[model samples]
Target: MSVHSLNRLIELREREVERLNVEVANKRAVGDRYRRSLERMTALCEGSGASAALPPALSLNCGNYKQAMLGMVDLHRQDLALHEADMAVSQRALDAAARKQEVFQQLLARRQAQLLREHESREQKRQDELATQVWWRGQR
Candidate 1:
């Protein structure tokens, strides 16, 4: 493949990797927030009041709160599962992109080597021409 095409592919692959990284970070953040919220609910229900275990207001909305808290916990589980699945897929894509990047690097190195050899060949031809001219000038 041409160096220009290879370079463009590399650039695209790098952008994809970066985008995936950001996506993974966002998924993790959402998962963490849900987990923390669940923890907070648990802590609040089990209160810090040494004698009264439940928060004063906690009893007022007992049945509704229990159902709501159960719903929240269920939603949290679903959210966690969704994020985990996303993370797995993203990791696989990133790994594939990394492999492609490695291959592109190798191809670039090979192309550079070929160009370097071509440049040296051209430089040698120029030097030989200069030397021939100098020898002819001396004879003249």
Candidate 2:
């Protein structure tokens, strides 16, 4: 393929890599949010334990609330686990995209270098031919 086409292909690959990078970053941000939420929920549950100072009715209510919060926390943990699994898959895809882009970049570099050498060779040959013609004229 021509150098222009190769360059275009490389550009497309670069865009793909960039897009994957964004996706990975977004996934990581979501994971961070989940972790923060889990931490907050755990702290709330820990701090909400029933105390002797509270009236019996209040104590019972607090216990129930804590139980409900614990259940919610468990659900959140499962959701976080699933999100992490999805993130792992996305990371793998990003890695693959980066590798593919690298390959295309290398190929483009090689092609450009080859074209440059071919151009220089042709220019040198023409110069040599011109010099030969001048020399022949001088000889005459």
Candidate 3:
């Protein structure tokens, strides 16, 4: 393929890589938030007091409190799992995009080397012709 086409492909791949980077970052941020929330919930339930205080004027039976906390923790766990799955997929996409960009760059490098070799060969041929002409003139 032409150098111009290769350059264009490289540019497109770079853009794709950039976009995937953003997606991966977003997924990670979401996952981080979920982790922080789960940590807070566990700390509140497991901290100093045997029975953690509920919000103003509200209270639950011992059985109900445990059940509610368990349910909330389970929900957070599920949300975290989903976020991790999304991050994994985003990471895969980023890797693929980077690989494509590298391939294009390698192709471009090969094309440049080929062009340089052709130019050098032509220059050497021209120098040889000049030398032959000089020898012929001297013979005359």
Estimate TM-scores for all models: 0.71, 0.88, 0.84
Residues 7-122 of candidate 1 have per-residue lDDT tens digits of 99888888988888888788778878878988987676445334335566664566466667667777877877887888889889888987888889889889988989999999
Assess each prediction's global lDDT (C-alpha) against the native.
0.80, 0.89, 0.86
The residue-by-residue lDDT of candidate 3 on 10-127, one tens digit each, is: 9999999999999999888888899899988777666524434654334445446656777898999998998898789889989999999999999999998999999999999999
lDDT of 2 at 54: 91
Per-prediction backbone clash count? 0, 0, 0
- Give candidate 3's error at residue 47 in angstroms: 3.8
| Backbone collision tally, model 1 | 0
Sorted on lDDT, best first, the list reads: 2, 3, 1
Q: Model 3: how far is 8 from its true place, Å?
A: 1.0
Candidate with the greatest lDDT versus the true structure: 2
Report residue 76 deviation for candidate 3 (angstroms). 1.3
lDDT of 2 by residue, 34-133 (tens): 9999999999989986556699999888888888888999999999999999989989988988888788878888988998999999999999999999
Higher-lDDT candidate among 1 and 2? 2
Output the TM-score of candidate 1: 0.71
> What is residue 93's positional error in candidate 3, in angstroms?
1.1
